[model samples]
Target: MSSPRISVILPCYNEESYIANAIESVLNQSFTDFELIIVNDGSADNTLSIINGFEDSRIRVIDQENLGPGASRNNAMRIARGEYMMFLDGDDWYREDALEIAYREITQKDCDLTFYQMINYDDETGDIYENDWFNLTTLDELDGKVFGPEETPGSIFDLSVGVCQKIYKSSFLRKINAEFPEGIFFEDMPFFYYVYLKAKRISIIKEHLYFRRKHDASITHVVDGKFLDTVPAGQVLMRIFIENEWYEMYKFDLLAYKINGPRFALRYIEEKYKIALYELIKKDYTEIKSSQYYSDFLENLGPVKKKFFLDIIASRNYQDFIKLNS
Candidate 1:
């Protein structure tokens, strides 16, 4: 058998209701020279059975114990045979021409990786919502930006994490050994940042190429009384700040984390500060305090923002802190 142009990986868990449609979306893609690898991550539902029902020989099913999406993707990448790899979540579906367009850019333009925008769909109502957060519309706008080299890293950190909406040359992925951290929530932020920094050239296609389903089951979703919610996903922001040494990238993450910390802290302390959570943030700040970067962060925090931090420390919860802001 000839090698396919792209390998599309779908990591499924308890998505029996949606897997058939997700599979149909990929099988129906305008580009036929692609392989689909669906990793069944210990789904208790009929997900595996539905996947087996597919007649396409291009689809390969790999059954494994539940290890979360990050690990499931890692397994798929390990055996992927295509020259390029596209990771899609099983519950979400893509536009017909997404792979065709992305692969065309990669092959013809010699771009290392290409990322496109996606629509957000409500799982309950089946209504599609366009995404506001991802800006994938124009590649020409980012022309002059330079990534350092293959060995040294640059700072276009958004590309690595959102695997589904992006196309990556298999050779580049092999060189970087890209994989999300297992057992961790928000695995993409770190993994994506790392991969983007290492790539020679990255492009963003602003078109909406995929539909990202949003509902109760998504990792990004928060629900009450669920173990995925109640269980400590830990303080991911603080860990990122402390573990990563790239200051340029560090500053970008810290700027966001620091701004959001007080809100997290308010939520943490309000709910009865877990000794673990408090230590995570305080220790993270303590470790980075002496870095000139930390001082730079403080100097850049405008008076109002500084006051907001102080208010968060003084007030009870986010709502009270908002009242203080008003």
Candidate 2:
């Protein structure tokens, strides 16, 4: 078998119920020039057996002890041979033409990365809703525009932190050593941020090419101490931006992100650790506000966000800040 043009990496962990459907979606893609790398992260269930049931030569399975999804992806990436790489979680599946559309746009536009939209599928309700991060109605206007952070800061910076929504050029990823932070809960935060910074040309397809499954068993839905990983993830992203001088270029977006990141922790973190997480975010905010580019951030904020910022700065306690923001 010749090397495929695209590589789809699916990392599984105890997903026996959905693993077969996910694999079948890839196999059934209209675009056939691809390989599916399935990394089973020590599923204590029947996930491994289901994966073994697929006899297609294009499917390569790597079974390892549970090392988390980030490590599993890194392991698959090392042996990936495709020109472009994409990720799919074990519980999630893709549209049949997803690879075909993404491949066409990326190859035709000659972009380093291509981000397509997704649909959120409610497991219990069986209802689907468009992922409206871009608020775009049609793909006709912005289908093949090749631009990066400098030209399209909002699009680049405001993208969801899920790596599954985008397809990356394998060479570009290898060039920047953009591997996920192993054993981290919010690894996508740092990984996708680094990719956006290093990407030279990015394209967007407004079409919904991926489906995200939202369920109680999903990692992001569970409440645990690991949720606090966002603090360190934010710090790692900030350090990378500062060290590479990207902070100044995208200061406004970064500022908004810094202020809002703690809100996610507040929502998901356990009550006892809330104050510590707030303090950590506040410390980062202090350093960011002290930067020379902070004035630029202030000037860019609208009245509402500006007032929120002032309230945050003036509040003496986390509860007051949350109340003011709320």
Candidate 3:
């Protein structure tokens, strides 16, 4: 009945088979002073029945109509009673020490947000993969190259945007009014960019404490959808950055757009929209001298992956790129 130090918010849809294991992973965590808030986002399956079977007082369940993951997470966050917050997806489970380790690191560093790495697992094939998604040169290296509130420009530079990997201070969350945008497929991209910019200090742990399951039903595994939708969603975030005069961040955004955005737009035009793929190419591909980041991105792309899009941009071979599209 005592107040908990951290509140773990989980948003569940139709995840009956997976929710129980996800909950148990937290309950069995080496760190136990945390409450679990599970939001059943209008599941037609047995997700609710399974959640109700849990007899723990620390587990609080909220039932609401299907409102997308972002809104569900925001709803739970509003009623969260912990000093710190962490997100655990319904279909994914955390390592026994994830929350424990993240809590310790955040407090020790006095960081507003502390994030770590993730190990991705394939549900069907049992294939396992791990990477330091943050691209941290060293996990043990901290305190140096730290960014102050004013010194660091806001950017879309991080490797992953899964909200679940980090622990956030409740006060800091309130200041930014941090909530994922609702009804969008790529909601986290915008949410992370905006919130990270507002934070006074941020930190990262180099260890992998989270296990991300790559299930076919999950949005992440739906490559076709992501390939089609991510760019448009990223474009919206780009506009938000530009309108705010965070010009320095544009380099990061442009890189993101070039790397992932074109695939989404091109996929949409080809499969669903049935529009001319050539026209989807930037009509005015003039250089924008905003920052070295952007210029560096172009230089990096010139000799790299020889895709139709790159060929068009690099060689001005619009005809060739268009021919490949056909």
What does candidate 1's lDDT look like per residue over 183-275, in tens digits?
755555556656665677766666788888888767656422222211122235334445555545456434544556333443534344443
Candidate with top TM-score is 2
List TM-score per model, in order.
0.76, 0.83, 0.78
Model 2 regions lying over 4 Å from their true place = 134-141, 272-326
Give the clash count for each candidate.
Answer: 5, 0, 1
Q: Which residue pairs collide in model 2, if any?
A: none
lDDT of 2: 0.82
lDDT of model 1 at residue 33?
A: 96
- Which 10 consecutive residues of model 1 have the lowest summed lDDT? 223-232
Highest-scoring model, lDDT:
2
Q: Rank the candidates by lDDT, best first.
A: 2, 3, 1
